[model samples]
Target: MLQISLFRRIVIFAILIGGLVLALPNAFYTRVEQSNDARAVIESGLSNDDLSAVAGQWPDFLPSGLVNLGLDLRGGAHLLVEVQVEDVYAGRLDALWPEVRDVLAAERDTVGFVTREESGTDELRVRISEAEGAARALELVRGLARPVVTVTGAGASDIAVSADGPVLTVTLSEAERVATDNRTMQQALEIIRRRIDEAGTREPTIQRQGADRILVQVPGVGSAQEVKDLIGTTAQLTFNPVITRTTDPATNVAPDEILAPSLDEEGVFFVLERAPVVSGEELVDAQPSFDQNGRPAVSFRFNPSGARAFGDYTAENIGAPFAIVLDGEVISAPTIQSHIPGGSGIITGRFTAEESTNLAVLLRAGALPAGLTFLEERTIGPELGQDSIDKGKLAAAVGLALVIVFMGLSYGLFGWFANLALILNLCMIFGVLSLLGATLTLPGIAGIVLTVGMAVDANVLVFERIREELKTAKGPARAIELGYSRALSAIIDANITTLITASILYAVGSGPVRGFAITLGLGIVTSVFTAIFVTRLFIVLWFERRRPRTIEV
Candidate 1:
């Protein structure tokens, strides 16, 4: 006979009620989203009476999570970016010069002086003055090389150093190049995500595409150009000691220094040391603020290690000028009057409030290791997304109505129970999605539509088995039990196979494909629960209360 313990019944009802409660927020999505946003702002230490009012719109007792609509469903900008990994090669070689020079200079009695010569874009060449000391110079440079730690890079040096006649050639090794490429891609993805997140845009998809490419999709961001503008900036902030201030372009500066034009003043140039005392990567915080002159500026604080480095540099180089370089332009060149032990300072430039705010955002996001070159870009309009959403809703409603009518006419009272369970299954799908903060895309809607049809298939199988059991001279209770028990294996088998397919899709695909897989997988789980447990519980309760002696098929 069909029977359910009070505890089992209560647990099933509790799950259904919990799912309904979680799914409730989506009905008032805009207000709940606003409340969530306001709550986040208040939690971030901002004081605003209006935020309190907004946050109170959603009840505190209710779950505030809502399903995130994807780029296709909400409209956005899409971009395919290829990171220029090779650009880091020249920089790596340029940075290696100081170490190479210092090492070679120690053995000056034997190797003599060395001078850098023009070479390939990816190579570093140093011409030793004495040809007899070339072997010693090469050995000294090779000592600077370290083993690459990565799996594929095992036993390989970070750089390849060789003696070519009187000159020594240096280039990044194959192993180090692979490691550098991986690091560059990861750093680029993180910086881009940070920059977009700081802008307060919702649910941006920033992911790696293959080896060197990044795929970026920002929902509600209208134009690809806008997103490009936000992440394209290589905001490399560094404080370099001023080698000299020169008006003449031909002023001979050391090879270790670079001449950068002043941002505030025209035609003025500050020749600064190529090695930075502190880089923006070391910055812990940055915000827009006013300088002592009441001009718009950005205030920044460094991490502990950077604080010590900056403090030491300032203490030793008192009275010397240090150039603050942003990108390729010198923002300011100020004389160090005293030691600045606290590594917090303001960047003074001729910037408007908006410019200062944007600069602060970039600085806070940190610098990208390599620049991105946009390979492809497109903007999806909100109108198209709305149309898709409208059509998807219509398709789902029509499908649901047709299925309900067919099931009701075919199976009578039992059909009504299956239809009710089907409706709850959809609620559970969205509820679980919201709970998990899953994104819903256009393909995801299609998955839901597919699920609506498949959900009834298990019920149909069970109903047919019951009809067959009735002809075998079994009573209604015995027939129902046999139907459900025998159909359970087929139901589990079919849904499990489909769930495996969705899992594979989620694993291998990106963006909309993953969204589809997510909804399909969740739908399968919810449908199985409602079919085997929820629908059965409803039938058992009815039969127990009524205690029917006979039933029509």
Candidate 2:
């Protein structure tokens, strides 16, 4: 009575063949990886003869997806960086100064002449010439305060205003500071992720650690310094109104002015306004292109708001030099020959093509909200990863061999069927991983080894049950049917419990732990299918062909 229908048999064989086909690329990982890379280049419209040759290493008809290797397996850069959230406070205060100046200037009759006063990094202070109108100055500044947007900060004003004599002090409220900190962290994480993705790295782990720390692990990068060079630069680009050109590094400037060294000329400096006409945040697109002289340069376009502001500034300040600043340094100070209306401009400097391309990428990714201080950095070598891979292979092979030998010795011919199912179960695991584009770590390899033993456990349970049923004087066919039917509940119960544990691990854990959980959970599913269905199908075929009347357990 134990039999598989023709339809069921076809389904089983189809799954086996499909899994094997999907998993075939992993057998030629290096060749397939090169082919994939070359294909990507070709698709990006930058293909060459060498790239075409490399892409042809693998057939076009086969699946090219691969199981991505984790940082532990592929070697990469690891960094722990602390975001300087306080830096954003200073920038916010700087931006608030122009609005405060304009507001107080509107009430010049009551508040008198207003000038920005030097204060703490987190506070903005405005001094009025008339001490009697202190209350009026404070009231005007407080009017600029907006309600914080965060739930916890609801009803709280973003800026707290107070008066001391003729000086009006403005600082971010406690709740607003907390809200800003959260926003800064989120923005920093997003910018870092974009920068790494723009660089075309695979399987990067970019996540927040504590309050201000970010952990970055980029697989396949050359070194930690290389990664630092990629993401560390704030790339804060701005166009500020140039006050005057100077050769002195220690030139005195007003509170609203900044003295920045020119990037092209060593000793030449430019004194510029602290507030910019348009910042990098308003940029909509940036690309690497050649300037009029055919030199490497970066071209950029602005959003609607940015275009309006840039157009107004250029129109009003024709014949005056406008400083293009990047992270506090004046990269270029070019004279505005005419009004540029379209909000499109080119930045030309002493740059190689590669540098210009990298600048374009950073510009497109947007600027980081805050500065990053590298707390720790490490570069893992591929040699170490290769060693780990070699050891992991040895352990998995040894465990698999031992399990196969034990099953073959214990249960005779039925054991051979179980061993074959175990092999297919592993192939299915790889197939699923490849299909999902999962990363494989050292711990993930251990999960696969553990699965090799677990894969045959259901077979062991069913074989032992058959031996017991045979002792009860049942016929071979009846005993085989009862054995599988009786063991089904136990097999399902055991695998279900393990799968729950794996799910929990995956939900709460990160990096290596998640890798292990993924492999373990996937292994449990494939193991149950192979043991209960594939092995049973094989036994059913053998029995149907032989029609044996009696059998040895």
Provide the overall lDDT of each model, using Cα atoms, as 2-decimal numbers: 0.91, 0.94
List, residue by residue over 1-553, the lDDT tens digit for candidate 1. Answer: 6888899989999999999999999999999999999999998889588999999999999999999888888898999999999988887888899899899989998788878887776999898888999988988999999999899999999999888788999999999999988988888999999999999888899899889999999988879999999999999999998887878767776666788999988888988888889899899999999988888999999999999999999999999999999988999998999999889998998999999999999999999887779999999999988998999999999999999999999999889999999999999999999999888999999999999999998899888998989888889999999999999999999999999999999999988899889999999999999999998998888898898887654
The weakest ten consecutive residues by lDDT in model 2 span: 544-553
Report clash pairs, candidate 2: none
Residue-wise C-alpha lDDT for candidate 2, range 325-386, written one tens digit per residue: 99989889999999998899999999999999999999999999999999999999999889
Residue 293 displacement (Å), model 1: 3.6
Given candidate 2, what's the lDDT at residue 254?
87
Q: Cα miss at 553, model 2 (Å)?
A: 3.9
Best candidate, lDDT-wise? 2
- Which residue runs of candidate 1 sit more than 4 Å off their true CA positions? 45-52, 249-254
